[model samples]
Target: MKRFALAAALVVLATVPLWVGSTYYVNIASQILFYAVFALAVNVLAGYAGLVSLGHAGLFGIAAYAAAKIMTSGHGHLAVAAGALAVTLAAAAVFAVLALRGTGLGFVMITVALGQIVWGVAYRWISLTNGDNGITISGRPSPFGLSLASPRGFYWATLAVFLLAVASMAVFVASPFGASVRGTRDQPRRMNALGYHVWMIRFLAFVLSGFWTGVAGLLYLYYNQFVSPQAVTLTASAEALLMVISGGTATLLGPITGAALVVVMKNVASAYIERWNFVLGAIFVAIVVFMPEGLVPGVARLVRRSPLR
Candidate 1:
């Protein structure tokens, strides 16, 4: 019943642009989908694998730059997007090997350091990335001759990719490998004693998480038609973490909801307040203090206690 209701809700949401009929709203919705993908990728690390990453934006930005470069070089958007995912996954494998040396705060520091390094490269590599000037994609690409330039077309394309990503991750979370990853999270020492390669499992999760994040980056590049060093900054990394916390860590839909809420709030508040970061910070603090489990979990608890449920 719950699943059916959720499916219906999604169907309604997919048609929102038809009713809203605003290019601005379509762009906003596209951003929601993009960030939702990013949040879900982070959830794979922090929520399922119990690995906290403060440097995911590094992977995200790398994928964005790769996708934009590929598209600019005459590759189809879909091809570029796929290439971005592949490169990110490969990078993740390398990162996992290096990161396996430590855990907890040590792992966090490694990721943060890696993120800074990547940011520096993106900023300094002026010939390739164009530095702080950023890169402008010539135009949106067509997959098999289907144009994706219009805002409405881009929105639909984004929605389709987001759904595909969500479905793929959902299946991944249900597979045996997923169970092994969760086992590592729950009892790493025990899993190691049981002769399981716990490091390998976590490494695989990290790679897969990077792949999804890369896909999100591709969508972001297409949606915004631009890529810059700012996209990969520590601030972006922190925003991804906040999205996971605000949505509900372990729940599949939590990250999506959290991203939507945060994006919408930012848009609305930025219109009225000059200091939007202060408002965003206040909201984050409020959520942490009063709803630590996130909006989804809090609502679920409320539903459980309700007579209607």
Candidate 2:
């Protein structure tokens, strides 16, 4: 029944552009789908692996810049992806080393510091990044031979990417290695005692998560056709963590749902209030204080106890 519900939800989301006549709504949906991918990437580390990162934006933003850089080189989509992958993997590997060396608050602090380093590079390196001016991707780059200049084409492309990312993550978490990683998360001491090589497991998880987020960054760059240092700052990193926590960690659908909810709320609230960031912060607080278990888990608990159940 839950599977059916999820399938139905997908159908609804996919057909949103069909029902909605406005291009604005279609663009909004595309943004949600991409952010969903980003959130899922964060979930891999924070949810299944019990690793909290505060510099996720650094990994993601690096890839976004890669996409932009690739575009200016007169390359095809595949070439752009390759460049993005190379840069992102290098960045991810470095971050994994730095992060895996620490644990708990120490790990989080390291991530924050590392993220700042990336941000600083983006800001100070005016020649490469264009500094505060941002990088412009004049026209949409074609994937294969298909041009996603239209809203519908881009929406479908984003959906396809989102589906692929979710499937990959689902398969990953159900594998034996994933179980071992989870073991490290749940019982690190026991796993270490059993020769689980906990540090390696954590490092692998971080790399995988960074790879996934790097893909999202590529999509994000294509969607916006711009990249700025501000996008990879501490605040952006915090947003990724919030998406995972608010949507329910350790669940495939949780991060995506959390992302959609956050995107929708931010868009809606920003129109009504001048202090929208305050509103966003308040919502985060409310989720942590009242819905610490996450909206999905909290709702599931109620469903299990209901008389109808």
Candidate 3:
């Protein structure tokens, strides 16, 4: 009953742009969806698998570049999207192979290095990425002869993908593979003693996280009609980490809520405050100091106490 109610609420929320009738609202909605997807991808690593990654922007940027390049070459077809997914997953696999060999700070360093390398490639590869100037695909491609350039059109498309991704992640978190990954996270030595390959599990989790991040990147490329090296910078990566942490690291829906709040707050704050980052930092500190488990968990506790659960 609760789940059904939640679904209905989401459907109503998804239709807000139609009622609001404003392009700005539509744009903000699109951004919320995009960042929600990005945050969810980060959740797979930090939430489910207990891995803190600061290089997701690398995967996100690479996938966006792949989509833009393919689209520019008159190949913005569904087939090209599939190819982009493949290439992004392949890059994830490579990163997994290299980073899974280490954990803790070593893993963090590896991801940081990977992000820097990707940023450099995107910036220096002028012919391919147009170097810093970025590439703008003329119009959004239709996956099945359906134009998605309009804000509302893109919003629905992105919402569908976001729903599907969330459902898939929910299923994955309840599956045996997810159980094993969690086990590896909690007690890797015990899992290894039981003959499980801990490193392999972590590597697979990394790849899955990358795949979802890639999908988000694809959506972002079409939504903004632009791709740039700055999108994959270390700051972007850190921002993702902040979202996951602030939202409640292990809660399934926490990152989405966190992303929405952060994005909306930043957008609102920048209009008035010159030092938005400082304000954001203060908010983060307060959240960390007051509600260490994140907003979602704290809200859940309050609801439980109110006889709502």
Off by over 4 Å in 1: 307-309
Q: Which candidate's TM-score is highest?
A: 2
lDDT of 2 by residue, 1-309 (tens): 989998998899789889989998899899899999999999999999998999999989999998888878788778888899789989999999978888889899999999999999899999999997889887776677667888888898899999999999989989998899899889999999998899998888998999989998988898888899989989999988898999899888789888988888778667888888887778778877877888788778778989996
Question: lDDT by residue for model 1 over 156-221, one digit each (tens)?
Answer: 878888898889878988999888889998999999999999988898889988888888888888
* Superposed Cα deviation of residue 140, candidate 1 (Å): 0.8
Cα error of candidate 2 at position 196, Å:
1.5
lDDT of 3 by residue, 1-309 (tens): 989989897978688677868888787877887888889888888887888888889999989999888888887468568978988999999988887777878888888899888999999989888999998977777656556877777788888898888888888889999899889889999999999989889998999999999999988888888999999999999988888888888777888888887887788668899998888899889888878888788777777889655
- Consecutive 10-residue window with the lowest summed lDDT within model 3: 138-147
Against the true structure, what is every candidate's RMSD? 1.7, 1.5, 1.7
TM-score of each: 0.94, 0.95, 0.95
- Please list the C-alpha lDDT of all candidates, in the order they appear: 0.86, 0.89, 0.86
Return the candidate ranking by TM-score, descending. 2, 3, 1
